[model samples]
Target: MTHPLRRGAAYAIGGAACFAAMSALVKTVGGDLPNSVVVFFRNAFALLVLLPWIAWSPGKRASFSTRRPGMHLLRATTGLAAMYCFFYALSQMQLASAVLLNYSQPLFLPFIAWAWLGERPPLRIYPAVLIGFVGVILILKPGMGWAGPAGIAGLAAGILAATSMAAIRRMSDTEPAVRIVLWFSVLGTLVSAVPAAMHWQTPSPTQWSALAGLGVIAAGGQLLLTRAYALAPAAHIGALIYTTVLFAALIGWLVWGERPDMLSGVGGLCVIAAALIVVVMRQRGSRTARA
Candidate 1:
């Protein structure tokens, strides 16, 4: 790979690792706090950490300007819902399962683009999507009656997250990425505060440290993801996000003593394969279009 591609890959991997760590921390504090509280603190602290950059840099003003408040609202709402479902499902189910299911978003992205944006995906995208679904089935093992509500919620979270991502792509044409992220943090914090207040459990010092770490880790991850996308095409950087699953599995094993069963392992492999295929096809299609 070229230096730029390599750099992008490294940044993407770093982002994925940070995200995986955040997930593990959240899982560690799963029972001690409500999902709302967790989400609130995560976003709130992230926003706090980002405030220095946002305040000191005059360049960020254009990003906050509103030529598209409606789009921002839609994106933020979808993002909020996605996070809510994700945190809830993660709290209720195994970490590996929730992470695997949520990572299926890329497989659904092509169809969502075709339907919502009127842009047809390449033929290979369909088979890749089917393969990803098979992977999900493997993880869930529904025929053996192992699937549960947490799995269903995770799927819902994936769909919502996919939708939000699609909207983010569209919004990126008009709005800055930082603006979208800032709005998401702002809206997420506000929306989560209500429910968090209702189920408020004061965090111990250790839990507070974990929550703070969650915020810092998530903020760093988002920055790295943004940097990666800026340096390379989405197809190149996006597929690398699958590394989060492996990271999640490893962290879960080391920290929580949670291990995926044989089915989940097989399913995770399939999902990774499908994601790689999608990335390859997208790159080829882009090259062909340029040629």
Candidate 2:
């Protein structure tokens, strides 16, 4: 039998794979649909999927009595901003580059934890964080002068995502995970409505199919992620999350004929390695504490 930890790791990997598939679908649709429209439909469909669970479990509703409503709104706003910038960056840049930039979230996690949780990570995490940043710099290659405003937007998206995730961690103690996701879907959909309406292009039949598929895939990804977190610590699963980048790169190559260059390939590997090191260190620390 697989160990519980390994099973949780599998869930994390599966979630990343599902998310990667969703990203591929998003990229396939490309600039054909506006980012706002895409975000709205994605969350709207996800909300539909979660409705059954909401109805079946009354406890889920009760968990929303968050003491920090302002924090929830702030997190939601940042999350929406991250999604917008991410989709915009994907439209403008290479998929692998954008994925690499976004995966820097794990590196930011330590700093956010220190600031928000008042818990400093051990010194070992510093080298891993530095290595991860180095990978980002390699991917950005200052001398190349290839980056533009979109690249900066992508970085901002990463920061916002990391911040939102930290806020989620903080609130998780007081709220159930399902409620957090439900709020994200509802709030994100409502927030995107204005922009989606403003930039609405009547999706063709094929585009409509793609949008439906994107929503289903995104919902599945979120479900898997939720299950994974229930089974293991976030730090234990963090490294496995990088698998999404590999999945994105593969999908981009097969569907869009985009390939990662030497810099991106090296940098991507470095980032993944650093994330893995961090996860391993965290797991070791947990084991020691238990001992």
Q: Write the per-residue lDDT of candidate 2 for residues 1-291, one digit (tens) a residue.
A: 248778888888888888788776676676788888888887787778877766676654535556777767878898889888877777777887787777777778768878998857889888988888888777777779755766777778888898998888888777776677767777888888889999888888998888888888788877777677778876767767888988888888888899778886788788888877876786677677789
Error in Å for residue 46 of model 1:
1.0
Provide the TM-score for each candidate, comma-separated: 0.93, 0.91
Model 2, C-alpha of 132: deviation from truth (Å): 0.8
Question: Please, what are the lDDT tens digits per residue for candidate 1 over residues 212-232?
Answer: 999999988988987898787
The residue ranges of model 2 lying beyond 4 angstroms of the native Cα positions read: 1-3, 58-63, 282-291
By lDDT, who's the top model here? 1
What TM-score does candidate 2 get on C-alpha atoms? 0.91
